[model samples]
Target: WVDAPNLASRILSMTQKRIAHDWMHCYQYAPVLIETFVETPRFPGTCYKAANWTWLGTTKGVGRLGNSHKPTLPQKNIWVYPLKKRFRQILCSNVQ
Candidate 1:
Protein backbone atom coordinates (compact mmCIF):
# COMPACT_ATOMS: atom_id res chain seq x y z
CA TRP A 1 0.00 0.00 0.00
CA VAL A 2 1.25 3.50 -0.78
CA ASP A 3 1.64 5.69 2.30
CA ALA A 4 3.74 8.57 1.00
CA PRO A 5 1.91 11.73 0.01
CA ASN A 6 1.64 12.36 -3.78
CA LEU A 7 3.28 8.99 -4.53
CA ALA A 8 0.07 7.73 -6.11
CA SER A 9 0.32 10.37 -8.82
CA ARG A 10 3.89 9.34 -9.64
CA ILE A 11 2.93 5.69 -9.78
CA LEU A 12 -0.06 6.44 -11.98
CA SER A 13 2.09 8.48 -14.36
CA MET A 14 4.64 5.67 -14.68
CA THR A 15 1.88 3.10 -15.28
CA GLN A 16 0.30 5.23 -17.99
CA LYS A 17 3.69 5.71 -19.65
CA ARG A 18 4.38 1.98 -19.59
CA ILE A 19 0.93 1.20 -20.95
CA ALA A 20 1.36 3.65 -23.83
CA HIS A 21 4.97 2.68 -24.66
CA ASP A 22 5.02 -1.05 -23.95
CA TRP A 23 1.58 -2.61 -23.44
CA MET A 24 -0.08 -0.93 -26.40
CA HIS A 25 2.67 -2.11 -28.76
CA CYS A 26 2.50 -5.64 -27.42
CA TYR A 27 -1.32 -5.74 -27.60
CA GLN A 28 -1.52 -3.89 -30.93
CA TYR A 29 -4.23 -1.61 -29.59
CA ALA A 30 -4.45 1.44 -27.36
CA PRO A 31 -6.84 1.20 -24.47
CA VAL A 32 -9.27 4.08 -24.05
CA LEU A 33 -9.80 3.57 -20.36
CA ILE A 34 -8.96 1.47 -17.33
CA GLU A 35 -11.26 0.41 -14.50
CA THR A 36 -10.77 -0.93 -11.02
CA PHE A 37 -12.78 -1.57 -7.89
CA VAL A 38 -12.03 -0.75 -4.27
CA GLU A 39 -13.61 -2.69 -1.49
CA THR A 40 -15.77 -0.35 0.54
CA PRO A 41 -15.55 -0.24 4.35
CA ARG A 42 -11.93 -1.37 4.06
CA PHE A 43 -10.77 1.33 1.65
CA PRO A 44 -11.90 4.84 0.71
CA GLY A 45 -10.10 4.90 -2.69
CA THR A 46 -8.00 7.88 -1.64
CA CYS A 47 -5.02 6.86 -3.84
CA TYR A 48 -7.21 6.43 -6.91
CA LYS A 49 -8.76 9.83 -6.29
CA ALA A 50 -5.30 11.35 -5.81
CA ALA A 51 -4.24 9.79 -9.13
CA ASN A 52 -7.13 11.61 -10.88
CA TRP A 53 -9.28 8.57 -11.49
CA THR A 54 -13.04 9.14 -11.67
CA TRP A 55 -15.42 7.56 -9.25
CA LEU A 56 -18.14 6.15 -11.46
CA GLY A 57 -20.27 4.57 -8.73
CA THR A 58 -20.53 1.59 -6.43
CA THR A 59 -21.19 -1.97 -7.53
CA LYS A 60 -24.11 -4.04 -6.33
CA GLY A 61 -23.20 -6.58 -3.67
CA VAL A 62 -23.46 -9.49 -6.06
CA GLY A 63 -20.66 -11.85 -6.97
CA ARG A 64 -20.22 -13.07 -10.56
CA LEU A 65 -22.08 -16.26 -9.85
CA GLY A 66 -24.66 -14.72 -7.54
CA ASN A 67 -28.09 -13.57 -8.60
CA SER A 68 -29.00 -9.90 -8.56
CA HIS A 69 -32.11 -10.64 -6.58
CA LYS A 70 -29.89 -11.94 -3.78
CA PRO A 71 -26.56 -10.23 -3.60
CA THR A 72 -23.89 -12.37 -1.91
CA LEU A 73 -20.84 -10.18 -1.84
CA PRO A 74 -19.60 -6.91 -0.44
CA GLN A 75 -20.30 -3.77 -2.43
CA LYS A 76 -17.27 -2.07 -3.98
CA ASN A 77 -16.59 1.39 -5.35
CA ILE A 78 -15.90 1.64 -9.07
CA TRP A 79 -13.09 3.83 -10.36
CA VAL A 80 -12.02 4.62 -13.91
CA TYR A 81 -9.03 6.25 -15.62
CA PRO A 82 -9.42 7.52 -19.13
CA LEU A 83 -6.27 7.42 -21.24
CA LYS A 84 -7.60 9.50 -24.11
CA LYS A 85 -8.84 13.05 -23.83
CA ARG A 86 -11.86 12.09 -25.94
CA PHE A 87 -12.32 8.70 -24.38
CA ARG A 88 -16.11 8.89 -24.23
CA GLN A 89 -16.30 9.82 -27.91
CA ILE A 90 -13.88 7.06 -28.87
CA LEU A 91 -15.71 4.50 -26.81
CA CYS A 92 -19.10 5.49 -28.22
CA SER A 93 -17.88 5.65 -31.83
CA ASN A 94 -18.95 2.86 -34.17
CA VAL A 95 -16.04 3.23 -36.62
CA GLN A 96 -13.80 0.22 -36.78
Candidate 2:
Protein backbone atom coordinates (compact mmCIF):
# COMPACT_ATOMS: atom_id res chain seq x y z
CA TRP A 1 0.00 0.00 0.00
CA VAL A 2 1.39 3.38 -0.97
CA ASP A 3 1.40 5.77 1.94
CA ALA A 4 1.58 9.55 1.87
CA PRO A 5 3.92 9.79 4.83
CA ASN A 6 2.94 8.72 8.39
CA LEU A 7 -0.59 7.97 7.22
CA ALA A 8 0.32 4.30 7.10
CA SER A 9 2.02 4.25 10.44
CA ARG A 10 -0.69 6.32 11.98
CA ILE A 11 -3.44 4.05 10.72
CA LEU A 12 -1.50 0.97 11.68
CA SER A 13 -0.70 2.27 15.09
CA MET A 14 -4.32 3.10 15.62
CA THR A 15 -5.39 -0.38 14.54
CA GLN A 16 -2.86 -2.03 16.83
CA LYS A 17 -4.00 -0.06 19.81
CA ARG A 18 -7.73 -0.18 19.15
CA ILE A 19 -8.24 -3.50 17.39
CA ALA A 20 -7.37 -7.19 17.86
CA HIS A 21 -7.05 -6.82 21.57
CA ASP A 22 -3.33 -6.14 21.02
CA TRP A 23 -2.55 -9.78 20.22
CA MET A 24 0.27 -9.69 17.74
CA HIS A 25 1.49 -12.53 15.57
CA CYS A 26 4.29 -13.00 13.07
CA TYR A 27 4.62 -15.24 10.05
CA GLN A 28 7.40 -17.82 9.71
CA TYR A 29 9.04 -15.83 6.91
CA ALA A 30 8.38 -12.50 8.50
CA PRO A 31 11.95 -12.02 9.62
CA VAL A 32 13.35 -11.28 6.17
CA LEU A 33 10.86 -9.90 3.74
CA ILE A 34 12.31 -8.01 0.80
CA GLU A 35 12.20 -4.39 1.89
CA THR A 36 12.79 -1.48 -0.49
CA PHE A 37 14.04 -1.81 -4.03
CA VAL A 38 16.73 -0.57 -6.38
CA GLU A 39 16.16 3.00 -7.48
CA THR A 40 18.13 6.18 -7.85
CA PRO A 41 18.77 8.01 -4.61
CA ARG A 42 15.74 10.15 -3.92
CA PHE A 43 14.78 10.12 -7.57
CA PRO A 44 13.27 13.59 -7.66
CA GLY A 45 10.17 12.25 -6.04
CA THR A 46 8.57 12.00 -2.65
CA CYS A 47 9.45 15.26 -0.97
CA TYR A 48 8.46 14.11 2.52
CA LYS A 49 9.63 11.11 4.48
CA ALA A 50 7.43 8.99 6.65
CA ALA A 51 8.78 9.01 10.17
CA ASN A 52 8.48 5.22 10.43
CA TRP A 53 9.66 4.17 6.97
CA THR A 54 13.44 4.02 6.72
CA TRP A 55 15.14 4.17 3.34
CA LEU A 56 16.38 0.70 2.61
CA GLY A 57 17.46 0.77 -1.05
CA THR A 58 15.92 0.82 -4.48
CA THR A 59 14.73 -1.46 -7.32
CA LYS A 60 15.09 -1.02 -11.04
CA GLY A 61 11.42 -0.96 -12.00
CA VAL A 62 8.19 -2.94 -11.95
CA GLY A 63 6.05 -4.48 -14.64
CA ARG A 64 2.80 -6.30 -14.93
CA LEU A 65 2.68 -9.88 -16.15
CA GLY A 66 1.44 -10.01 -19.70
CA ASN A 67 -1.51 -12.10 -20.82
CA SER A 68 0.94 -14.29 -22.76
CA HIS A 69 2.65 -15.20 -19.51
CA LYS A 70 5.61 -12.98 -20.17
CA PRO A 71 7.45 -10.61 -17.89
CA THR A 72 6.79 -6.96 -18.59
CA LEU A 73 9.01 -3.96 -18.06
CA PRO A 74 10.81 -3.78 -14.74
CA GLN A 75 10.36 -0.97 -12.22
CA LYS A 76 12.33 0.44 -9.36
CA ASN A 77 12.14 -0.95 -5.87
CA ILE A 78 10.74 1.55 -3.39
CA TRP A 79 11.32 2.11 0.30
CA VAL A 80 10.00 -0.25 2.95
CA TYR A 81 10.14 -0.68 6.70
CA PRO A 82 9.32 -3.05 9.49
CA LEU A 83 5.75 -2.80 10.67
CA LYS A 84 5.41 -3.19 14.37
CA LYS A 85 4.03 -6.69 14.97
CA ARG A 86 0.86 -5.43 16.55
CA PHE A 87 -0.02 -3.44 13.44
CA ARG A 88 -0.35 -6.65 11.45
CA GLN A 89 -3.84 -7.05 12.79
CA ILE A 90 -5.15 -4.79 10.05
CA LEU A 91 -4.46 -7.60 7.61
CA CYS A 92 -6.83 -9.99 9.37
CA SER A 93 -10.36 -10.29 10.63
CA ASN A 94 -11.51 -8.67 13.85
CA VAL A 95 -13.89 -11.50 14.73
CA GLN A 96 -13.58 -12.68 18.28
Candidate 3:
Protein backbone atom coordinates (compact mmCIF):
# COMPACT_ATOMS: atom_id res chain seq x y z
CA TRP A 1 0.00 0.00 0.00
CA VAL A 2 1.35 3.38 -0.91
CA ASP A 3 1.74 5.65 2.11
CA ALA A 4 -0.08 8.89 1.37
CA PRO A 5 -1.82 11.67 3.25
CA ASN A 6 -4.69 10.58 5.48
CA LEU A 7 -7.51 11.75 3.23
CA ALA A 8 -9.05 8.46 2.21
CA SER A 9 -12.43 9.00 3.85
CA ARG A 10 -12.89 12.49 2.43
CA ILE A 11 -11.66 11.41 -0.98
CA LEU A 12 -14.12 8.52 -1.11
CA SER A 13 -17.10 10.74 -0.40
CA MET A 14 -16.02 13.36 -2.94
CA THR A 15 -15.29 10.81 -5.64
CA GLN A 16 -18.62 9.04 -5.19
CA LYS A 17 -20.56 12.30 -5.36
CA ARG A 18 -18.68 13.39 -8.46
CA ILE A 19 -19.37 10.08 -10.16
CA ALA A 20 -23.07 10.29 -9.39
CA HIS A 21 -23.25 13.86 -10.66
CA ASP A 22 -21.37 13.10 -13.87
CA TRP A 23 -23.45 10.04 -14.60
CA MET A 24 -26.72 11.83 -14.03
CA HIS A 25 -25.85 15.01 -15.94
CA CYS A 26 -23.29 14.10 -18.59
CA TYR A 27 -24.62 10.68 -19.48
CA GLN A 28 -28.26 11.24 -18.62
CA TYR A 29 -28.10 8.23 -16.34
CA ALA A 30 -28.53 8.06 -12.62
CA PRO A 31 -26.49 5.58 -10.64
CA VAL A 32 -28.48 3.95 -7.88
CA LEU A 33 -25.64 2.46 -5.88
CA ILE A 34 -21.92 1.89 -5.63
CA GLU A 35 -19.97 -1.02 -4.19
CA THR A 36 -16.42 -1.78 -3.12
CA PHE A 37 -14.49 -4.65 -1.59
CA VAL A 38 -11.75 -4.39 0.98
CA GLU A 39 -9.21 -7.05 1.79
CA THR A 40 -9.67 -7.02 5.53
CA PRO A 41 -6.50 -8.99 6.15
CA ARG A 42 -4.47 -6.20 4.66
CA PHE A 43 -6.63 -3.20 5.38
CA PRO A 44 -9.83 -2.67 7.34
CA GLY A 45 -12.52 -0.64 5.57
CA THR A 46 -12.34 2.37 7.86
CA CYS A 47 -12.63 4.86 5.00
CA TYR A 48 -15.75 3.24 3.61
CA LYS A 49 -17.34 3.03 7.05
CA ALA A 50 -16.52 6.67 7.71
CA ALA A 51 -18.21 7.57 4.42
CA ASN A 52 -21.43 5.90 5.62
CA TRP A 53 -21.20 2.87 3.40
CA THR A 54 -22.96 -0.23 4.66
CA TRP A 55 -20.95 -3.31 5.43
CA LEU A 56 -22.77 -6.09 3.64
CA GLY A 57 -20.65 -9.14 4.32
CA THR A 58 -17.50 -11.00 3.39
CA THR A 59 -16.89 -12.95 0.22
CA LYS A 60 -16.60 -16.73 0.28
CA GLY A 61 -13.34 -16.53 -1.64
CA VAL A 62 -14.01 -19.85 -3.33
CA GLY A 63 -15.49 -21.02 -6.60
CA ARG A 64 -17.01 -24.30 -7.56
CA LEU A 65 -14.75 -26.43 -9.71
CA GLY A 66 -16.70 -29.37 -11.08
CA ASN A 67 -18.09 -31.11 -7.99
CA SER A 68 -15.87 -29.44 -5.47
CA HIS A 69 -15.17 -25.92 -4.28
CA LYS A 70 -11.65 -24.60 -3.74
CA PRO A 71 -10.18 -21.45 -2.43
CA THR A 72 -9.06 -19.13 -5.20
CA LEU A 73 -8.60 -15.81 -3.55
CA PRO A 74 -8.52 -13.99 -0.26
CA GLN A 75 -11.83 -13.08 1.35
CA LYS A 76 -12.83 -9.46 1.08
CA ASN A 77 -15.39 -7.46 3.01
CA ILE A 78 -18.21 -6.10 0.89
CA TRP A 79 -19.37 -2.51 1.22
CA VAL A 80 -22.05 -0.56 -0.59
CA TYR A 81 -23.33 3.00 -0.75
CA PRO A 82 -26.63 4.20 -2.10
CA LEU A 83 -26.26 7.04 -4.56
CA LYS A 84 -29.97 7.70 -4.83
CA LYS A 85 -32.53 8.33 -2.13
CA ARG A 86 -34.76 5.51 -3.39
CA PHE A 87 -32.00 3.22 -4.55
CA ARG A 88 -33.68 0.07 -3.23
CA GLN A 89 -36.91 0.84 -5.01
CA ILE A 90 -35.08 1.64 -8.23
CA LEU A 91 -33.07 -1.56 -8.02
CA CYS A 92 -36.06 -3.76 -7.24
CA SER A 93 -38.07 -2.29 -10.11
CA ASN A 94 -35.26 -3.08 -12.53
CA VAL A 95 -35.13 -6.69 -11.44
CA GLN A 96 -36.93 -9.03 -13.82
Candidate 4:
Protein backbone atom coordinates (compact mmCIF):
# COMPACT_ATOMS: atom_id res chain seq x y z
CA TRP A 1 0.00 0.00 0.00
CA VAL A 2 3.08 2.23 -0.17
CA ASP A 3 2.68 3.16 3.47
CA ALA A 4 6.39 2.71 4.15
CA PRO A 5 8.94 5.49 4.15
CA ASN A 6 10.55 6.20 0.73
CA LEU A 7 8.31 3.57 -0.88
CA ALA A 8 5.98 6.19 -2.27
CA SER A 9 8.81 7.89 -4.12
CA ARG A 10 9.99 4.61 -5.67
CA ILE A 11 6.48 3.66 -6.73
CA LEU A 12 5.74 7.10 -8.15
CA SER A 13 8.99 7.16 -10.09
CA MET A 14 8.31 3.75 -11.59
CA THR A 15 4.74 4.70 -12.47
CA GLN A 16 5.83 7.93 -14.13
CA LYS A 17 8.50 6.12 -16.10
CA ARG A 18 6.00 3.49 -17.23
CA ILE A 19 3.48 6.15 -18.20
CA ALA A 20 6.08 8.02 -20.22
CA HIS A 21 7.30 4.86 -21.90
CA ASP A 22 4.86 1.93 -22.00
CA TRP A 23 1.52 3.74 -21.59
CA MET A 24 2.34 6.47 -24.09
CA HIS A 25 3.31 3.87 -26.65
CA CYS A 26 -0.04 2.10 -26.23
CA TYR A 27 -2.22 5.23 -26.45
CA GLN A 28 -2.67 7.47 -29.45
CA TYR A 29 -2.77 10.58 -27.28
CA ALA A 30 -0.54 11.18 -24.29
CA PRO A 31 -1.69 12.83 -21.10
CA VAL A 32 -0.28 16.30 -20.51
CA LEU A 33 -0.92 16.37 -16.82
CA ILE A 34 -1.84 14.21 -13.83
CA GLU A 35 -3.70 15.44 -10.78
CA THR A 36 -4.66 14.16 -7.36
CA PHE A 37 -6.07 15.44 -4.08
CA VAL A 38 -5.03 14.55 -0.56
CA GLU A 39 -7.27 14.86 2.44
CA THR A 40 -5.57 17.53 4.59
CA PRO A 41 -6.60 16.01 7.90
CA ARG A 42 -5.46 12.52 7.05
CA PHE A 43 -2.39 13.17 4.87
CA PRO A 44 0.34 15.79 4.58
CA GLY A 45 0.97 15.03 0.88
CA THR A 46 4.61 14.24 1.57
CA CYS A 47 4.71 11.56 -1.12
CA TYR A 48 3.47 13.92 -3.78
CA LYS A 49 6.09 16.46 -2.76
CA ALA A 50 8.81 13.83 -2.90
CA ALA A 51 7.62 12.86 -6.37
CA ASN A 52 7.94 16.50 -7.58
CA TRP A 53 4.22 17.27 -7.83
CA THR A 54 3.26 20.90 -7.52
CA TRP A 55 1.01 21.93 -4.67
CA LEU A 56 -1.63 24.12 -6.23
CA GLY A 57 -3.67 24.83 -3.11
CA THR A 58 -6.52 23.57 -0.99
CA THR A 59 -10.06 22.93 -2.14
CA LYS A 60 -13.07 24.84 -0.78
CA GLY A 61 -14.21 21.84 1.26
CA VAL A 62 -17.38 21.43 -0.77
CA GLY A 63 -18.40 18.18 -2.38
CA ARG A 64 -19.48 18.02 -6.01
CA LEU A 65 -23.18 17.75 -5.09
CA GLY A 66 -23.03 19.94 -1.96
CA ASN A 67 -23.96 23.60 -1.69
CA SER A 68 -21.03 25.96 -2.12
CA HIS A 69 -22.15 28.19 0.68
CA LYS A 70 -21.92 25.33 3.15
CA PRO A 71 -19.02 22.97 2.83
CA THR A 72 -19.92 19.39 3.74
CA LEU A 73 -16.50 17.78 3.37
CA PRO A 74 -12.96 18.29 4.55
CA GLN A 75 -10.71 20.53 2.51
CA LYS A 76 -8.20 18.66 0.33
CA ASN A 77 -4.84 19.70 -0.99
CA ILE A 78 -4.63 19.91 -4.78
CA TRP A 79 -1.55 18.45 -6.45
CA VAL A 80 -0.55 18.31 -10.12
CA TYR A 81 2.23 16.76 -12.18
CA PRO A 82 2.95 17.96 -15.67
CA LEU A 83 3.91 15.15 -17.99
CA LYS A 84 4.73 17.42 -20.91
CA LYS A 85 7.06 20.42 -20.98
CA ARG A 86 4.43 22.52 -22.77
CA PHE A 87 1.52 21.36 -20.70
CA ARG A 88 0.49 24.89 -19.77
CA GLN A 89 0.54 26.02 -23.38
CA ILE A 90 -1.38 22.95 -24.50
CA LEU A 91 -3.95 23.34 -21.79
CA CYS A 92 -4.43 27.05 -22.47
CA SER A 93 -4.60 26.66 -26.23
CA ASN A 94 -8.11 26.75 -27.65
CA VAL A 95 -8.07 24.06 -30.28
CA GLN A 96 -11.66 23.09 -30.93
Ranking by TM-score: 1, 4, 3, 2
Tens digits of per-residue lDDT, candidate 1, 3-84, equal 6867778888788767755756898888888889999979999989988899999988888876566767788999999888
Q: Top TM-score: which candidate number?
A: 1
Winner on lDDT (2 vs 4)? 4
Ranked by lDDT, the better of candidates 1 and 4 is 4
How high is the CA lDDT of each candidate model?
0.85, 0.45, 0.85, 0.87
lDDT per residue for candidate 4 within 1-96, as digits (tens), equals: 555768889998777766766656897667788889999999999999989999999998888888666878999999999988999899989766
Kindly report which residue stretches of model 3 are placed more than 4 angstroms away from their true locations once superposed.
1-6, 24-28, 63-68
Clashing pairs in 1: none
lDDT pick, better of 3 and 4: 4
lDDT of 3 at 36: 91
Following a full C-alpha superposition, what root-mean-square deviation does model 3 have from the true structure? 3.8
- Estimate the overall C-alpha local distance difference test score of candidate 1: 0.85
2 versus 4: better TM-score goes to? 4
Higher TM-score: candidate 1 or 2?
A: 1
Whichever of 2 and 3 has more lDDT, that candidate is 3
Across 1-96, the per-residue lDDT of candidate 3 in tens digits comes to 977775888788788879978887889987889999898789999988888899999988774452446657788999999888988898899688
Candidate 2 lDDT tens digits, 24-88:
25332333222444435435324214434456554434445446544344445465544445544
Clashing pairs in 3: none
